[model samples]
Target: MKKQSYGMKWLSVEVVVILVGLLFLAPFYFVLTNSFKGFAELLVDTSGLPKSLSWDNYARAWEVLNFPRAFLNSLLITLFSALCMVVAASMAAYRLLRHPSRINRVLFSLFVAAMVVPFQAIMIPLVQVGNWLQFLNSIPGIIFCYTGLGVSFSIFLYHGFMKSIPLEVEEAAVMDGCNPYGIFWRIVFPLLKPMTITVIVLQSLWMWNDFLLPLLVLQKPELQTIQLATNTLFGQYLKQWDLALAALVMGIVPILTFFLVLQKHVIQGITAGAVKG
Candidate 1:
């Protein structure tokens, strides 16, 4: 009787899980199905499958949205920003953890405090500063901004994980005549693989998907990211639902591919971090 009850409970839980997943996926189903539809058909029956597969919407979206350029731009920005944040945050966290000076402690506290401060609160001042620095609409400019904004959270993650590492590891490296930079590059960094991957994946997703920052900073059509490019498909009088949905799908595919490939590492990183502290 107990075994039967356990099996029944497991089946019930499985059914609930499947239902929840379907609930989340239903919207994507609509988008995917309607992406091949004509605008008229979409307006008439938004939920139905296409009468016939239409490749024109995807092709038109690609050309009108300048998807190739946007994809390249997003790739460059996200990769550079993620790399900068990971390298800077990892080094900073390592030194701060090893040394633990009062200044370092105060600075780390300030970073954590900054994380709690909403980005909306400082958007105006940030824009003013960006304008003053003449970084308002440039790719390099936005990359720098992403690095700064991403550092705090990355540092927080690294700092927590670094606590689990032994001080003796650094001491051993130093005894072997390793300089600070050498120790960090060779020994410390290698041990930080899991956390680093976690930071890269999370930050890459955020930087790639972000719309507001790009919209605020980049006015030039040539400088637009994928998200910004998709927004252009919408008009005051006519919304190109088919084209917009296609572009949306195009923008999502790369990130979804990335997550699928690195999903195991991501899960392990989170699990390790949670167990450590």
Candidate 2:
């Protein structure tokens, strides 16, 4: 009797958790299904699946949004920015960990402190600086901005895990006549793979999905990121629900595919960091 009761309780809990997950996923389902429906059908029944599959909405949205260009722009920006941030941050973290000087300590603290500073507070000043630097509407400019903003948190995560790496390994490499750069590149960097993967995955997602920064930085229609392109589907008086939804689906696909593929590494990276620390 007690075994049966416990099984029932477990089943109930599982069902509840499933229901919660469904609740969170409901919006995505609505967007995906409605994207295939006609305007009239969408208005009549937002929740139900479309009576007939229609590819026109996606086709029209792709052309109107210039999705191919937007996708490429987003891909380039995100990939470059994330790569720069991970490499720079990892090197910085490694140096800070190995050196451990007062100045490095102060800088590390500042990086941690900067994480708490809201972007809104400094957005105006950042924009002004970008304008002064002629980075106002350039991809490289946007990449530089993302690299700077991402460094603090990335450094923090890298720094924490770097301490777990044994100093003996670096010292042995040094004794073998390896320079600092050589030692870091060959020995330390390989040890940092897990944290590096973590940083790459997390930062890539942020850069790929980022809307506001790209919107402010890239003015040319040809340079707009996927998020910016998707926003163009909605106007002041008229919102193309079908097109908007289609664009949204397109925007999410790449990141979703990336995450699905690297999910194992991502989880392993995170767990390794936790265990090592």
Q: What is the per-residue lDDT of model 1 for residues 18-132, given as tens digits with 9 covering 90 to 100?
A: 9999999998899888889888898999887789988988899999998999999999999999999999999999888788789999999998998998888988888999999
lDDT of 1: 0.91
Clashing pairs in 2: none
Tell me the spans in candidate 2 whose CA falls farther than 4 Å from its real position. 1-12, 275-277
Q: What TM-score, computed on C-alpha atoms, does each candidate reach?
A: 0.96, 0.94
N/CA/C clash count, model 1: 0
On TM-score, the leading prediction is 1
Worst 10 residues of 1 by lDDT: 268-277
Deviation in Å, model 2, residue 177 alpha carbon: 1.7
Candidate 1 wrong stretches, greater than 4 Å: none
| Model 1: lDDT of residue 14 | 100
Candidate topping lDDT:
1
Tens-digit lDDT string for candidate 2 (91-184): 9998887888999999999999999998889889999999999998899999999999999999988887887888899889988999999998
Clashing pairs in 1: none
